[model samples]
Target chain A: MRLIFMIAVLAAGLLYTFYAFNTLNFLSASGRLGPGFFPQILGLGIVSMTLISVITEARRMRATTNYFAAPADAFPGSALLIICMSVLYLIGLRLFGAIPGSIVFLLAMFWMISRGKPILNTVIAVMAPVLIYLLFRQLLSASMPEGLIPLPF
Target chain B: MEIFSDLMMGMSVALHPANLLYLLVGAFVGMTIGVIPGFGPAAGIALLLPVTFGMDPVGAVMMLSAIYYGAMYGGSITAILINTPGDAGSVASTLDGFPLAQQGRAGPALVMQAVASFTGGTVGVILITLLAPLFSQVARNFGPPEYFLLAIMGMLTLIVMIGGNWRLGVISALIGFALGTVGVDLESGRSRYTFGSAELIGGINFIPVAIGLFGLGELFFAFYSGSHKKRDGEMLTYDGKSNFWPNARDFIETRFTLVRGSIIGFVVGVIPGAGAAIAALIAYSVERSVSPRPENFGKGEMAGLVAPEAANNAASSGAMIPLLTLGIPGSASTAILLAAFLMWGLRPGPLLMEQNPEFAWGLIASMYLGNMALLLISIFAIPVFVLILKVPYRILAPLVVVVCTLGTFSVNSSYMEMYIMLGAGVIGFFMRLYGFSPAAVVLALVLGPLAEESLRQTLTISRGSFGIFITRPASLSIIVVTIALLVLLPLIQLYGQRVRKPKAS
Candidate 1:
């Protein structure tokens, strides 16, 4: 079943490459290398590798291997939590810059991680990223992206 | 003698006080992260890159070198104690060390592993000093087409060597390759599969995806499986009685294994697609083939313990071949190293060796001394590392997740990457629980962009004919090897199974 799924995906990739190459123009009468020239060649390679993948999948379909096993149920509620944190991080970094954004991400992450930890532990984990960022940006002068609300670099 | 002279020159630069201190710090941090389950040298290197971005090129490389070899030293510790190899590179060590642990010989097993790693590092460093310039000269002969074929070969390598079911490996490689296609096509600047997201114009980074798939995925599965409802075992406690040094007999037997393993490792490392994991596997198999008492392997044999360690450390040295000589990276870790190099405005390739011999040679020298420092530090650090294992997974697991999240977020300061990590983490966890090698995914991600770009360049040069792959001698031969690997790997596996069937009956 998964093989079929993969074949479908491979087919789509090849078809897309074919279509993309057909629609794209060379955009030049002549040059050392035309833009379309590279795309077409890449499309061909993709098509070839995809073909190899299809043949290999078919061969494996005939082969014997155990497929089923117990599925895992670990880390419920983690993805959503991750998504929320990431959104806040995206919004926060611009406002606070590297130091504050990192502090927020780290402390919140520590809270998520520490489970029942005391305030001190949260503060420590939070401080780790912030301190590292300060050391890099201020002391070492490593440049970083300043998001929405820029703090002093 | 030339090797010694070059090495002496290398030491002159490596031993500078500032350089030496970085090496020490790199080794220490490398060991700490390496010994931890689900974190290894690559992640350690990735995390350190942005932090070290401002350092001088030599100092930056000094720390990375320490981490590289130090991780090699630390990998076998968990393999012995917890029956879990911290990284794939150390998996072979577990076959012997874990069994020795079962037999209450963990100390000897660990000591043996550490000694083997040191020897391997010594051999590997020698090869780097002697072989890099020579091999690099050969690598310069490669054109864009050849490098493209090399990446293709890397994909096929994962196809066979992936530890789990072959089907999943193919799927994992496919998905990884496809994901790599998401960003702007280098030749056209046209996005392939980004679905019109401006954020993905640069493509999906393997760093975040790799961290998610390996670190986050593993963490989720550890808790989700619920297999370990009860933790009732004395595996960690009693092993204190075993001697923590390889016996004279072990030394006598394993000396050749270390040498052979390191040599094989360097050769594999030189291969464009093959990396440390493949080298280690090949080393383990070579030792098995050459062992007088073959049945002793995988049953607490010192040869098993030493072969993989030597191979992995040597392969780390091997990876430097491309970086120093050809400018292409053969593995995921090296890819980051490349980025770090570029960050420092130091272009690494053919010109690098010619323009900055001291810098290049100095980096090589650090590994020789760094590996020695790793050996000494690890000996005294084992008792402490074993204690870290005592931390309950309940807390440690979440902490891992958080660190990976923060690490991902901090790298680009893009929360979009953080979300990508979570989604990729889920896919990766399933990939892992299903037996797909995370390294394969990482490899795909690392090489996918380069492969895509090169294939297009070669085609453009060839005027859109498929014959371009073979018309060029170098590209043609590399493709042949990839095909040969794909075909021969299955046959070899079948033979191994057939041979094992008789014994089972």
Candidate 2:
């Protein structure tokens, strides 16, 4: 079942990659080297490998107990934390911008990492991101996203 | 004698105060990251790369090189204390490293790692200094066929050698080739894989993927495996004080492991697909099999710690060989290093050695000096690293996560990158659960683009004859080797059983 799923995903990707390559006009011999040649071959490689893996995995399953077993919990609580944190971090970015959102995000993360020390960890996390923001933005002149809380002068 | 004169000149360039300052700063920063849990030398180097973008090519390379060795020295600290390798390369160290700590030999374990790393790195640097020019001269003769062959050879080994289901590994590699196709098709103005998303047109940046997979993926794994028993605590009071120097007998025992590992590291480092972590693992396996007291392994045996550390360090220097010579990056760290070169408006190719001998020679010299510095400082610094670990994981986790996110944000100010990071993090978290090797996926993601570019170029030249790869000697040899490995795996396993049968008897 998992092998099937993998093959399906691989096929989808291959098809998309092939179409993507062909859609762009790559059928020419103009320059020293033409454009579309690399993409098409890459697409084919992806397709061939995907097929090969599926076949091999299927064979292994037939010979042994099975191939590609999904565990009881493919997505666990800890992974959920990552999902929530990432989504929240993205939300923070959209709402606050990279700097201020990162500040809040880092603070919460610090709170998470410390396990029990909330306030102190939050302070360190918040301060670190803010200072990093200031350093990169002000000194390095790299433009960061303008989050809900803009970087204050 | 002539080589001695060049070495002296190289030292002169490396000794400049400006260069020295960067080296110190780089070493200090690199060690800081290395000492921290979860950040390997590659990740450490990636984190520090932004700081060097501002310096001159020579200074930048010097500092980066210093950090490379410094982080190597730092990676062992957490391994000994926590039994958790901060980077994959140091995973072997945990076999004996944490055991030694448990047995109150933490000090010696660390000293072993540092000294071994320095020896390997020093030898690797010497070899690189001698070998790079020779390789580059050979590379100068390379044509389109050679580059094409090199790419094929690179992909072939990756498919055969990396640990995993071989079929799945190939799938991963092919996917990587696809991703490499996403960025502005370098050979042509036409874009592929952009799918009208402007953010992606610049392409899926490999750095963010690397950081997300190694850094964020690891953090996610730690969280997922939170229920796994953590080590009780460090043996803070166990203070056996052996001389920091590894003695002659120690050398006699570990010399073969060190040499074998150095050679493996250098060779692996030169290959784009076979990286340092794999090299270290392979070396450690060899060390285990070869050791007279195999049972002593994973219980803080000196041999276990020495072999992998040496391989990991040598791999660092070895990776530079391909980059400097063939203008190809053997590993992710070197890949990032290559980006720095590009930003400085330097194109690495056949003529690179001829055009930038000073920059090349200076970087190699600095690595030599960096090795000496790492060996000198680590003698006194291991104690301090243990102290750092005692601060508690709870605090360290928060700090590391925060710093990682900030570094992620800084790498590109794009909040979108953070989203990509977040998405990748979530995917990575689940990948760990499903038994997918994050390293495999990450390497696939990292090299996917390169493979795609090479494949596309190969076909463009061949005009539909994919067999053109077989026509080239280098490419054909690599492809043949890959096929042989694919066929020989079961035979090798059978041979292993045959050898072990007598032992079983």
Candidate 3:
């Protein structure tokens, strides 16, 4: 699993490096260092470092007799589910509104984290979003996105 | 006399009734967050950055500084009672603090920690008041070349000393620098990496990224690791019978240790990359080595507790010097503070005194008051902090998520910021899992634009000659030291390995 994460990270770094290099114009006659120059340097450095890390990890895996001896968190399914829910929450808030979206997001997350203490989760999930909306909108005067249901505060 | 007058003016600004209330609130929040196992000063500040966004600059900074020192004071509670270091800086405290607690002397231990923390924090602030002005004078001579070199040196030292793995640190920093370049170019007036998105023109706000990385990322880690699972073991509690204050004799005996640790911690804090954790460890070892009863060290010795508590608190204060005087953050918390400085539209450096004397002096004055408040709060608020720890992370996570979501969105009232935070949180989680330093990324993100602009300006001034970096005296010295550590030190180590291997063969 650790090896997989390393590989994934390396791939992401490489992909980004390639994209940044191709996207940015590194050469400009106006100055020795252009706007793109720093990003390109960073891109190159990331690729090199990721390569080193990947090679090192690969060697370590080969040398180790019991690969599982290395302590790594078992990436819990619940955690992955929570992450996905958060993504949905963000999108929901974007499309609908902070209040309605927060209610649904909070309910699902609270239930998930509490492992189905439905009554407590429901109570918290309902109350927290409203309280947050009031505090942020009324007290702080924060500009929040208005959606299907308009907020008074 | 001049410094005294400046500080007096600073005190007037800091003592504004509203600022005082914010200071108390900051200390309370800092202490509470410090008591929680997975949260520390950095995360707490990041989470609360939004709250300060609408505040007066002086008041906001005073509150944040309070939080920083308060967390240092509050971190010892869990270390002493539960044998869990609430913050990394308090890990050394657990060696003797937990033992003292187990022996049913938790009150004396707690008192010792508070008193030692007070001593260290006061001394550190004193040194800051004296040294920051002197450093400001030196910083006045720095140009683009010098600033560029200083940034490089700061980054290198952070990677070598704190990141623990140079390769991982480099990768993380590079990724951070890349992220920093996401917005429209200030000089060229051309969008570099926006990829045609209107939102990308404003670039990635460091606050959301910070909150997500340090706050939400840690929450994700706590969940997956199941570290929040309630431990079945009993935690040592105060029985209301023990002395809640260390005896006068104990203080009189350990006075020298507290002063020595404070000096060591302050000096280390002033140095880039040597944070409170290292300061505490070094102070602990120094006290252990020099003690007449060295054998009693780490076996519930008073000196052991005093050394780390004093040093870490002092170091937290000391870390402010570099950030305030040079605009170089020595640690993650200072990096966030640096962001705060930028957000408030005040640049911290030599010119800060001239440009924003009120902000600079007011913050320093507030630190003095904040330390006193922290001492009072920590001593009185220990039970409240202990109770807070019992609140399950399950309930806490949702609250944190909601706060962070609102906070991130409040930055620009942009929902896109929330999405960015979620993505950054996931990346930050994996970065932590893979032994990469999140601090490195953050420091890079904060410093990258400065470094890049300086480098470009230096080159532009020198007509594209790279020699400009090495030709200037200050920049040259910094570059030489950076090279020795990054290149020569590793070469020497490899050569030594080869030499020892031949003898073994």
Candidate 4:
């Protein structure tokens, strides 16, 4: 897992470096340090350091058989589920707007995480959206996602 | 006499009913955020930053700064009660805090910590009041070369303090610098890495990235660690009836410890990258070393709890010196504060006090009042926070996600920023799991543009000769300090480890 993350970073670093070198100028036409100068250094540094980290992490993992062993406390299953749910919630926000999308998301989330409490979940799902709507929209007058399907007050 | 009158003007500003109300709200919110394990001031401030958009700049900054120092007071509550440090700054508090709680001295422990924190915080503000003007006067002479070197010094000191994983820390900071290079080049009128998106043209908004990384990312990691499933530890209860307050011996015995811890914490806090956690740990170590009863150090010693509490609170104050005078944030939380300052069109530097006395001194004065408020809150409001702790992480997780998402959207009403926040959250989760420093990334992101601009200007002035950094007295001084910090931080870390190993064993 660590090796994969490091490799991902390295790949991104390489792409960044490629763009920095190919697209951006190191010195401006007027002979000043241009936009690429900083990014070039940063990109190269990231690529090199990440490559070293990957190599070191890979070597260490090879020597340790239990490197893949999950800790007793880890709940990767639930964590992954939450991530998926969050993505769905984002999609819901796009479709149904802030209030309705948040209501659905909260209902679904509470049902999943805090089971056997429909009454509490329902109350929270309804009230939380209303409260957040009040706080963001009414009180602060901040913009909320009007969504493709706008809601009437 | 001049300082005295300036403070009086600040007091008048801070004492306004509206400003006081904001201060109270910030203090309350800060404490609430701090009580939750895994949620620190960085996340709290980011999560709330957008809400301050319509607020008066002084009130907004006062509230944010309150949240920053207020977290220091709130973190210890959980550390003492549940053996879980709410933030890194409270880790040392758990050493003696939990032990003291276990010994059934939880009440005394809690009150004494509040007192110690109040003392340290107030003393820090006093020092700030006296020294900030002097520091500002000196910092006014700094040129581009000096500023650039200072930025590098901040990053290097942070990386060096990351101990064995210094390479990974560097990589994390590099990632931040990379992110910071997004958007149009202000100088050359060329977009660097925006990929031709209008949203990308403005570069990444700091609020969403901050909220995602520190808020959602930390929450997700907490879930991954099975914190939601784990039942709370047996809480040591303290009814306000009996044995609640500390005895006279508690204060008398630790009289010198409080002073020593405050001074150490303040000094450490003034240094870039050495934050409250280091200050607390170093104070604990120093207190132990100098104690007549070293054996009693971690065994529910009043001084043990007092030293770290004092140190962490003072360190929080100490960190403000750089931010207020030099416009450089030494830690993730302060970086968010800097972002807030910029959002309000208030650039914090040497001229901040001269140009915006009302905002600067108003903030400084609020800290004095804030420490008093926090002391009262920390003592009288314990039961409220204890109730907060009873609320499980499982239920809180989704609501937090909702807040982070909606908060991101509220800032610009832009779906793209929300998406960026979500992406950053996922990436931040992986970063946390893999031992990379998210704080370092955020700090670098804040400092990257400043560092780049200053370096370019320095080179331009020097005709592309880097020797200008050595020739300038201010730049040379920064170089000497950076080198010294790079050499000294590792030794300090070593000493902290040496002291910590015994307690761990």
Question: TM-score of every model?
Answer: 0.81, 0.84, 0.92, 0.98
Candidate 4: pairs in clash: none
Clashes of each: 5, 10, 0, 0
Instruction: Select the stronger candidate by TM-score from 2 and 3.
Output: 3
lDDT of 4 at B170: 95
The most accurate candidate by DockQ is 4
Winning candidate number (lDDT): 4
Off by over 4 Å in 3: A65-75, A115-123, A145-153, B231-242, B480-505
TM-score of 2: 0.84
Model 2 chain B weakest 10-residue run by lDDT: B227-236
Residue B103 of model 1: what lDDT?
Answer: 73
For model 2, report the TM-score of its A chain: 0.69
Interface RMSD of candidate 2, in Å, is: 3.8
lDDT of 2 by residue, B190-218 (tens): 66767788888888876666566666666
TM-score of chain A considered alone, across all candidate predictions: 0.58, 0.69, 0.74, 0.95
Show model 1 residue runs off by greater than 4 Å.
Answer: A1-153, B1-6, B163-206, B225-242, B434-438, B465-472, B487-505
Candidates ranked by lDDT: 4, 3, 1, 2
- Residues forming the 10-long window of minimal summed lDDT in candidate 3 chain B: B495-504
Give the 10-residue window scoring lowest on summed lDDT in candidate 4 chain B. Answer: B232-241
Candidate 4 lDDT, tens digit per residue, A1-153? 788888999999999999999998898899889889999988889989989999999999999888877687799888898889999999999999998999999899888887756897799888988898889898899999877876784
Candidate 1 reaches a DockQ of 0.21
Candidate 3 lDDT tens digits, A6-107: 788778777777766776667576545667788778777887888888898889989988775535555466567767877887777776787878888887
Residue range B178-218, candidate 4, lDDT tens digits: 89999988998798788879888878889888998998899
Provide all candidates' interface root-mean-square deviations: 5.5, 3.8, 2.0, 0.8
Model 2 lDDT tens row, A29-128: 4644445665666576667767776677678779866345444544356555655776777677667776567667767765554446677666766676
Looking only at chain B, model 2 earns a TM-score of 0.85
Better of 1 and 2 by TM-score: 2
Which of the predicted structures, 2 or 4, would earn the higher TM-score when compared with the native?
A: 4
